[model samples]
Target: MKKKLGLTSKIFIGILLGAILGLILKGMPDSTFKNTILLNGILKVMGSGFITAIKMLVVPLVFVSLVCGSSSMGDVKKLGRIGIKTLCFYLITTAVAITLALGIGKLINPGIGLDMSSLITQKPTIGESKSLVDIVLGMIPANPIQSLASGEMLQIIVFSLLLGIAISMVGKKAEPIKNLFESANEICMKMVSIIMLLAPYGVFALITNTFATTGFDAIFSLLKYMFAVSLTLVLQAFVVYASMVKLSTGLKLKPFFKKFASVAAVTFSTASSNAALPLTIESMEEIGVDNSVASFTLPLGATINMDGTAIMQGVACIFISQLYGIDLGINALLTIILTATLASVGTAGVPGVGMITLSMVLTSVGLPLEGIGLIMGVDRLLDMARTTVNVMGDCACTLVVSNSEGEFNKDMYYGKDCNNLNKLSESELNKDMHQDEDCNNLNELVD
Candidate 1:
């Protein structure tokens, strides 16, 4: 019998095979194979189904996990501190990512020779942007049910935070509710595992369709733009994130990378941070991050922290500017950074979100929104790469927060049995019950 391969191995194989199949279809002269069969048939159905399945879980998972995280904190003050730190860290990293991308784009000049003016452009309909005050006020959902229905992640986060704090303040009276979320969280995580079983096949269809539709000529024509964006993503993920993790937690890079490679692959394949949260949280637990920290930070990170997207905006802005023969002054670069940073939050969790924010960034600096369509050919591929970096940013923030709180598990993170690590066991829960009265008698109930 053939030995069973791990999920990661299977996913990698799916991606490989999908790429080969896509290339074969791309090379074919007749449009019959790609247009009639691959693009519109098997690949379309499976890919759409997979993305839908993942999205279905996002709201519930985030809601339950975040409530569990908030209630577990036991102290409202600490929760506040965690919130502040997480926000600051996310924003800081985003600024850094964008800054780096701008610097690199300038050096590489990815758009110098690309003349796209003759291409007709359709004006994208953009709603009036919210002011800073409006944005802050909007965080408190007028109707949380509406927020949930619409999948408004920022509103969900705010409402969940308030709910969790209220539960914590209620003390033993809220134990039943808290326990319910814990159970719900566990069930949801199991659902994630079940869904992930389809990842290999789903990823195959997604990749195959992407490559088959996006011709090699378009990809190669803008190879330099692709190279710059890809290079910046790689640098942000490895050099910048690795450095932050090392400096913050004193954790070894080898084990972190070993564990994170799997998460990165999922992020790349799915291109949705919310979709990858279940696995990311699971990986964090296996690496020994405290449940409270991992649950809170990762969900919040997914919703608000978008360093990878920031990098893309920064690079794309410069590339577009160069293509138009527009010279960017220091003030224009600053505007791009500020606009991109704020836009990342304003546009959180929308489908095809990057291009929307890219348009906003372009408008901020007097660059034409039409320039966005010029890069659409390679955007799908770059979206995959940047999404990987985005999730990596979330994981890095989780570790940093975990370390600062002294909740990080250096031993589990470095241990050889990391893959086999399970959730908190019965005996452990019992011991915790004996130690803390406010644990809501979870041991008794769960046992």
Candidate 2:
């Protein structure tokens, strides 16, 4: 008998093979077979289908899991505390990412002595950043169903939080409803598992499509910008997030990254946090973070937490400023930090949103709006790395909050007795439940 390959191994393999295939396609001459059959026909269909499959689960999973996590507490005040901690961690880390990007941009000088004639020929359409007032009011949805239909994540989170609190306030009267939400949450997770079965194929197709059209010419020209952005993202994930997990939860970092590898690959391929939400939550359970915290924080984090995007914007802003020989003052850098932080939270979690928010950051410091075109050529490649960091930020916050609230399962984190939980007798489970309030995860353990 042969041992089975895990999902993580398969996904990475897909990425590797996909990149090779994509490069081969890029090298080939332009032909109907390449464009009509290969690029648009198979790869596009499979990749888009898989993304649609995963995104289909995000709304239901967030709504159900959030309600389950929120109502499980039975205390609105605990929910409030979790909210504060989650937001603070998200916002603070985002600011740190921005500052780091600025430092990195200066060190690398990605745009010093660059030619902007070809790139900045036409002004890119700059999307307007929403005012803080508008973003605040928008969370209160006039029609939550419309928001869900449109996949408005922040709106969905607000509605879910309200529904959860109402469910908790009713107490015994809401028990049946709470049970229904819990069951629904389980079913949604099962759906996620089902969709993830096709992840490797989907990931392969997605990567293939990207590299097939992305020729090496643009890459050669903007390689420095690409290197700078990539370095910033790497630091954000390994240095900042590693320190955060160690400091916050006192957990070893190896197991955390190892468990999260497959999700990171998928997130890198998909490049949308909402599209990756299903896998992110599933991975959180494997990392020993409770569904309560994972459920609440991950969904909200996907919406407002844009640490990864902030890094991209910061680096791009600096790169652009240098392209036009604009010297940024210390006050301008401070403005970039504050503006990018707010813009990140206000921006949606869709793919390419970083570009939209980067416009805001650039405008704050009087840089050319058209400077965005300078880096657009390689944004697709860099986008994958940054999205992975955003997903990590979400998970890190979940771990820290879960550990602080005593909702985390250390035994699960250490890979001890994970399978044995299912073997325990009812009395054994009851005994453990008394010792740790987080045994609900044990009750729901599949293995």
Best by lDDT: 2
Write down the lDDT of every candidate, Cα atoms only: 0.73, 0.74
List TM-scores for all candidates, in order.
Answer: 0.58, 0.59
Model 1, span 91-161: residue lDDT tens: 78899999999999998988776554332133322223555465457657999999888765556767876
Instruction: Tell me the alpha-carbon RMSD of every candidate.
Output: 12.2, 12.7
Mind sharing the TM-score for model 1?
0.58
Q: How much is the lDDT of residue 79 in candidate 2?
A: 85
Clashes of 2: 0
Measured on C-alpha atoms, candidate 1 has an lDDT of 0.73
Stretches off by above 4 angstroms in model 1 are 1-78, 117-221, 416-447
Candidate No. with top TM-score:
2
